[model samples]
Structure formats: structure tokens, C-alpha cells
Target: MSSVETVKNSPWQQGARDALPLLGGYIPVAISFGLIAVQSGFSALETVLISALIYAGASQFLFIAMVASGAPLWLVLVMTLLINARHLVYGPNIAPYLSNSRWWPVLMHGLTDQIFALAHTRLPQLEEKDRMGWYISAALIAWLSWIVGTAVGAVAGAEITSRWPLLGEVMPFALPALFLVLLAPRFTSVQWTLTMLVSIVAALVLKLMGMTNSAIPLAALCGVSLFYLLQAKLKAEGEIHG
Candidate 1:
């Protein structure tokens, strides 16, 4: 490619292009969320604002559900924080590739589970100077798609669902399907497989026990903690054997 072409189709542009597949998942799920929020008595504007401001997929659904159920704001806040605490791990893992960019704190707003997964895989292969641009591009596209999807859902979700009831049922699966797509490639070892199986079992058990609200976060914590503990054990055994 010519230098001009390269500049025109920069890493930023590539990132946005790479994020296009996310729209298929993000839009439908976001629309579902918008519909649910609106049906739950939130105004269309509030629905859009929630997607724009919070942008925390499943957590937003949980937030709306909690609010509708008259859960206290403090409890809602705690649950939201607990669900998103995985970001602490995500941010640090991606920070090295950011090359100490001053805009990181601001850019971090765009971080999401899918974005983190994509960045973890792609960033290391990018030129140092291109990493931030690519990240910003991918994040921006994903964010905008979500906001637009929410708006559509807030405005017309009921109509859409009423016309195609099956869509309403299927929309909920989009998020989980997207997650499986993102994580499937990483199940490259016994450890990863075991961690995922454990997490799945934990989540299922929690849900069966009527701890649905805590299942996701607790299960995620269980998986991550187990992976780390396994890693530590392996390192110790390797040192002793060496």
C-alpha cells in the first residue's frame, strides 16, 4: 500500500473495522436492554442515557431490574461495582501496550469485556505508536454502536418485539453468544478449560440457589482466582523440579 493509503487506513481505522462484528451482537442486545428499561418505567431518554453513561451490558440490565424492584440505590451501586471489578485486572493487562499515554484515564471509559478481549489479542501485534489509536478506534465504534442501538430500542423496542416475539427471546442470547465467541479461542490449555468449567459450574449453582444477581461476578472471580492459583502452583513446582 502507498504511504498515503497507509496513513488513511491507519491502525485506528483498522481497529474500527475489526470492531464491526461486535455490532451484530451489541446492537441487538442493547436494543433488548433499551426495550426492557423502557418497559420498566424508565423514560426513553433515561434508557439511552443509561446505555451511554453506564455502558455496562449485563450490569445495565441488572441495574434496571434492581431499580424496578425498588432495591436501594446503595445496593445497586455495590452490585454494579462488584460486577465491573474485573476491569481492575483488564486495565492493568492492557496498560503496558498503552505506552503511558496521558489519555488512558479518559480512554478507559470505553473499556468493556469485549474490548478488553480484543485488545488483549490484537494490541501486542501492533506497533507501539499504533496501539492507542487502534484501541481508541475500536472502543469508539463499539460505544457508538451501543448508544445507537439503545436509542433504537428505547424508541421502538416494543414495536419490534411485538411484531417478532421470537426476536425478543433471541436477543437475550446475543450477549452470551458474543462472550463465547470472544473467549473460545483462549481455551488453549487444560488450565483454561478447567477454569472455565469451574466458573460455569459456579454460576449455574449460584443461579439455582436463587443468587442470580451475584452469579456473574462471583463466578468470574472464581475463574480468575482459580487461574492465578493454578499458575502459582505450577511456578512453584517448576522451581522445585528445576
Candidate 2:
């Protein structure tokens, strides 16, 4: 490659290095997905395909769980889409930084929660010309780590289950545990705490009201709306007092 190409590619390497910490966090959660997928009667191939194609960690867990329980196909599709609707918010936030590259579609395909979180916080610090390369590189590292972790988990799942059935039963909880771990640090903020509480209550109430699969989407909508309203209200009160 020419020196020009090398200059263009350097940001990709930098992005990979920056995302190294995320890889440590991703591996165990992805391994759990693979293990649970196989335990839910998916072939190793099917498990990997779901991880590769769908690539939504939380939704994937919900997908396999619902499918295992014999939920209708339409419901499964709707639920997965509902669970991932939050990505719409992430997309617009990152769009201006995409560098208008021809390869954006490929990069966007793998934009997960962790990728978005990192990109939103770090991209502005990057040189304008390097933002796309860094974003893509970081996202690719995370994607590959998930896929590799899933493969390892799928391969080892059978032996582990055979030897210790209870441990296999515990695998599905990993997704929830992972979320708790991620959210723990953020709970120091009142807004985040309120959002979490609102979402949980709304989801539970909607579920009790016979909304079933629709509960999550509706609840998330309510929580986000309430959060914004609260923020606006606070701002208004502060202005009045000031």
C-alpha cells in the first residue's frame, strides 16, 4: 500500500486499541449467549449465525428465550425489533461523524450498544478525517470478539452441560447480570435511576395489562418520554428560581 493508504489506516489501529477494554467485557456475555443458545436446542451453527446476523446482544438473548418457549414467529420478530428500537437513537447521533464513506453500510451493520457508547463519547476527540476509520475499527474489534466468544462457548457448551446441568441452567441469567454490571456505575445519576425505575414499572404494568410482547417497547417509550419531561421541568424551575 502507498504511504497515503497507511496514513488512512492508522486510525483503524488506534480505534482497535481504544476498544480493548470493551473486548474484556464482551467476551463473557457473548459466551453466555452461545452457551444458552446451544442449551436451548440450537445447533452450534445456528447459534453463530444468530450472533453474526442479528448482532444485538440483549435482543438475541430474548430471541432465543422466546423461541425456546414456542412464541409465534411474528411475535418473535416484533419483540426483537422492539428490544432494539433504541438503536434508532444511536444512529442519528453517529451519522454526522460517518465521513460519508462507501463502506458505512458494512460498519453500521455491526453497531452494537457498546460500539455506540464508545463512539458517541470518543469520536469528537478524534481528528475529523479519522473518525470513520476509528469508529469502524473499534466496531469491528467488538464484532469479532463477540463472534469468537460465541464460537468458543458453542463448542464447549455441550461438555459443560453434560458434566454440570445446574451450571447450564444458570447461563441465561448472564445477560441480566451483565446489564446490571454495566448499569451499576451509572446509577449515581438521578436521571438514570429515574429512567430505570420508570421503565421497570411501566413494563411490569403493561405486562399485567395483557400487553405481552408489546410491553417492553411501550414501556421504553414511556420511560424515555418521562425522562425528557422531567429534565425539561427541572430546567424550567431552575430558570424561574434563578
Q: Pick the candidate with the highest lDDT.
A: 1
- Model 1, stretches more than 4 Å misplaced? 1-9, 166-188, 200-213, 224-242
Tell me how candidate 2 scores on lDDT. 0.77
What are the per-residue Cα lDDT tens digits for candidate 2 across 51-154? 99999888899999999999999999998998788778887888876677788766788778777766765676667888887887888888888898788789
- Return the clash pairs for model 1, or none: none
TM-score of 2: 0.68
Candidate 1 local Cα displacement, residue 24, angstroms:
2.0
Model 2 spans with C-alpha error above 4 angstroms: 1-9, 158-242
What TM-score does each of the candidates earn? 0.78, 0.68
Q: lDDT per model, in order?
A: 0.84, 0.77
